[model samples]
Target: MTSLSGKNAIVTGGTRGIGLAIARGFLEAGATVTICGRKPENVQNALDALADYKDRLLGISAHVGKSEDLEKLISASEDRFGAINVLVNNAGTNPYYGPIVDSEDAAWDKTMEVNLRGPYQLSKLVARKMLSSGGGSIVNISSIAGLTASPLQGIYSVSKAGLIMLTKVMARELGRQGIRVNCICPGVIKTKLSEALWADPQAEKQAAAMKALGRVGTTDELIGAAVYFASDASSFTTGAVLTVDGGMVL
Candidate 1:
């Protein structure tokens, strides 16, 4: 088992869904976690729900896509947990779900800002702390859409693809400095953000039939990967992209 007993991790967009699941899993594995959501209410709700681990958890309200907010997030986490040992860039957005050409400037920019740019900026900030703290891990929650375009989610797919490249670029540069950067591509995960894939019977059936597991995956399925990437278990791994799609992409 990967142990994160002494590790301090920050998970963005962690008030619900995949990010929330990962946060709970990390806490279960003994890591101190800081979770963020855009709304203070959501953050408080998560904290209350996870009250069992309150001593090991912190909740904050911040927008990952905003530079000032990201700065404050890091500062607050640093103050609470000392130097962060793990950063899970799980915050993302898909404001528009339509054809590439039909995507407006606002949607395109929002998707890029949240899914790609935010992680890039946050990684830079955390990597500096990791360097001084001796070492750390950065786990990016990219989507399988990044590897293979999803119909009607053109701009979101494009943004995720950029994230995959960003993961590799940062990994190569930071690997020598003891910071391992990796990306995980999950397919048809049954999260609020991915409701479109499962809420519609036709889409859900297609997604389930395509997967070797014969079903869309639960958020819990991702915990293992998240934990491994954040722990010393993957000490020699860096710049790698893992697909946790239950063979859906095959």
Candidate 2:
């Protein structure tokens, strides 16, 4: 098991879904965690939900795409936890779903800002703290859309593809500082964000059939990869994209 007894981690967009699961996994592994969301209510809700592990959890409100918000989040984490040893850039947006030609400029800009730019900026901010703390790990929650084009979600796909590149770039630039960066590409996970696909029986069946494993993934299925990348288990691994898509890409 990957132990994080003395480590501190910050997970963005951690009020629900995969982000919540990752925060839970970190707490279970004994790391002190700070979770952030865009809304104060969501942050409070997450704090309530994780009250059982209050000794190691802190919840805050911050929008990952905004520089000022990101700065406040980093400052709050440092104030509560001393130093940040792990960062999970799990917040992202996919507000538009259409063909590439039909995607409006606003949707494209929003998608790129949240999915790619947010992580990029957060990584840069956190890498500096990690260097001062002697080292750390960063796990970006990208998507299989980044690996293969999804015509229906063209703009979102482009943003995620940019995220994959951003992950590699951060990994390369921060390696010398002992900060490892990697990404996870999950496919059709059962989350609210993916409700549009799984909400319909036919669509769910079709999605499941497309995977070699003959099933869709779950939030729990991706936790191990987060644990691996955040822990010493993957100390030498960086600039890598671990696909947790249940054989969808195979």
Candidate 3:
């Protein structure tokens, strides 16, 4: 098992889906984890679910897209865990799904705000903190759509692509300080955020068929990549985008 017994981590949008899975993985590896979601109720619910690990878990409510919320999140995590060792920018939004030509301005702005701006801001805040307390790893959760386009998700795709570039920029700027930055581009993972693509039998089959592995990826399958990036296993792997897409790009 990858051990992170002395580590402290913060995972945004961690009330459910990929974020929740990542938090669970960190806890299993013995890291003290702080999870954040936009809703206080959801955060409480997540805390309740992970009650067995109460001593090592902290749940906070914050909207990553909002600067004030992000500030509060970082403050709360630092207060509870001392210093953050791993920061996962996993919170994202896709408010619009349609042709790029028909996409509304508000939809595009909202998508950019959450998917791109939020991560950028959070990474900046966390990186500064990490620099002062030695250094740490920052993992940005991107998507396969960022590398390739899907007609209905143009805005979302664009935002994710920007995230990939942001990861590189952070790595370049932070490497001197020992803060490694990287990204994960997962394909059609079975998460609530991706239910629109996988909930339908026909769509799910089509998505699976496109993959060389012949199946949509499970949450567990992507957890290893996250663990590898977070642990010392990938100490030399920075500014790299690890794809857990079942060879869909192939």
Candidate 4:
């Protein structure tokens, strides 16, 4: 296992699913973690679930789309765990599940606000702190959807593709400053956010058969990739996109 001892990390949208898995994996690897969700109850639930870590795990309620909230989350994380050296931009949303031409303006705005803009703003804030504190690593959780567009995922695919580009830009700009930026593009993970694709019996079977592994990915399966990015194991890896998609994209 990759070790993150003495590292301070922050995970957004960490109340459940992949974000929660990444947070737990970070703690298991011996890092101090601060996680945030948009809801108070979800934050509390995650706090309770990770109680064994005690103060090592801090849970906060913050909307990634709000700059003030992001500021507060970062400030509180630093106050509790010192300088954050690992940042996981995992928060995202796909409010619409329809054709691109039929999509409304509000859907596009919200999708970009949470999926792309939030990470852009947060990375800038974290990179400045990282520069002051020596260096850090950033892992953006994009999706295979970004690599290949599918029906009903047009806006989301665009936003995620933009995120991948953002990762590359940040990595190139920050490499000399010691900050490594990379992206993970997962496919058909079994999470609530993807219930529409995996919940129905027929759809689930089709989804499974599409993957080389013959099944959808679990949240825990993405942990190892995240750990790699958070640890020195990926010290030389930047501006790269790791796909953990069960070969569905292949």
Candidate 5:
């Protein structure tokens, strides 16, 4: 049982799916959490749903791919909660799902900007604060697409793969400063973002057969790993990638 009690956290793309699950788990573990989504209504809905936590939870509308929005989110987290001790880089986008040769420049750039660049920028901002405040943990929500090639997801795969290396770079450079950086690669989660893979009967069956667990995973299934990475349980773990993919790659 890991605990994040007394910790302050920022979860990006936290209004729904995996990010929302992570935020709920952090609140349950006694941490003050600031969650952000691009849409104001989604943020408000999340805030209302999590109102039981009262001052412990804050919801902000921000786009992870935008530098100015990212800055505001960090400032808001500090103003409301204090020095951020945990950052879960869960915001990601997959705009063009096609062959790499077919991907246009805009598609490639958008995928990279949101999935890879966003995490890098957010981690840099939070790492500085962690260094000043005695260190913290960063958990990036990458995907199994990073570890292996996926059909029709070339650019998204490339972006996630880049994120894995970025995690290593950050961990190696920031370790001395007490910031731990890690990555999580999830597989076939039944979220709207992944509906195309799982909503179709043939695709879902094929995906499930590839996993040792014999089924696609749910958003809640990834929470434990995120909590572990965020808490002291993984204090010595950095630059590591944890796969919560129901053994799909195996």
Candidate 6:
């Protein structure tokens, strides 16, 4: 296991699903973690679920789309855990499940705001702190949908594709400064955000059949990848995209 002992990390959209799983993995790996959720109750719930690591876990309610909230989350985390050594941009949303042309402006705005803009804005803030601290690592959670467009998730695909580039761009710009930026493109995983793709009986079967592993993955499966990126295990790695999709079609 990759050790993140003594590291301070921040995970966005960490109330449940992948984010929560990653937070738990980080705590177990010996890192101080601060997770943010949009709802206070959701944040509390996640905190409760992760009670085993209460001493090392912190939950805050903040919206990634808002700059003020992002600043507060960062500031509060820094004040509590010292400088953040790892950042996971895992918060995202796909409001519309339809053709690109049919997507409304609101859907497009919200999708970009959460999936793309939030990461971009938050990264900038974290980068500033990282720059001052010598260096850090950033792990972005993208999706295979970003690599290949989905008919129904058109807008979401576009946003995630942009995230892939964002990872590379930041990696190049920050490498010289000691900050390593990488991305993870996960295939269909059984999570709340991805339930539309695998929840129904027929949907589950079709989704499983599409993967080379003949099945969808669980949240825990992505933990190793997250840990590797966040820890020094991949110290020399930057601007890389690791796909953990059970060999699903790209």
lDDT of 4 at 134: 97
Over 4 Å off in model 6, which ranges?
Answer: none
Q: What is the TM-score of each candidate against the true structure?
A: 0.98, 0.98, 0.98, 0.99, 0.98, 0.98
Scored by CA lDDT, what does every candidate get? 0.92, 0.90, 0.91, 0.95, 0.93, 0.94
lDDT of 4 by residue, 56-169 (tens): 999989999999999999999999989999999999999999998898999999999999999999999999999999999999999998899877899999999999999999
Top candidate (lDDT) = 4
**Runs with alpha carbons beyond 4 Å of true place in candidate 5:** none
Clashes of each: 0, 0, 0, 0, 0, 0
Q: Could you give the candidate ranking by lDDT, starting with the highest? A: 4, 6, 5, 1, 3, 2
Question: Judged by lDDT relative to the true structure, which candidate is superior, 2 or 3?
Answer: 3
As for candidate 3, its clashing pairs are: none
lDDT of 5 by residue, 1-250 (tens): 4888989999999999899999999999999999999999999988988888877999999999899999999999999999999999999888888898977999998898899989999999888889999999999999999999988998999999999999999999999989999999999899989988899999999989999999999999999999999999998999999999999887
Worst 10 residues of 2 by lDDT: 94-103
lDDT of 1 by residue, 121-215 (tens): 99999999899999899999999999997889899899999999989999999898899999999998888898988999998998899899999
RMSD per candidate (Å) reads: 1.0, 0.9, 1.0, 0.8, 1.0, 0.9
> Which digits, one per residue and each the tens of the lDDT, describe model 6 over residues 94-175?
7899888877899999999999999999999999999999899999999998899777999999999999999999999999
| Model 3 segments more than 4 A misplaced | none
Clashing pairs in 1: none
TM-score of 1: 0.98
Model 5 earns a TM-score of 0.98
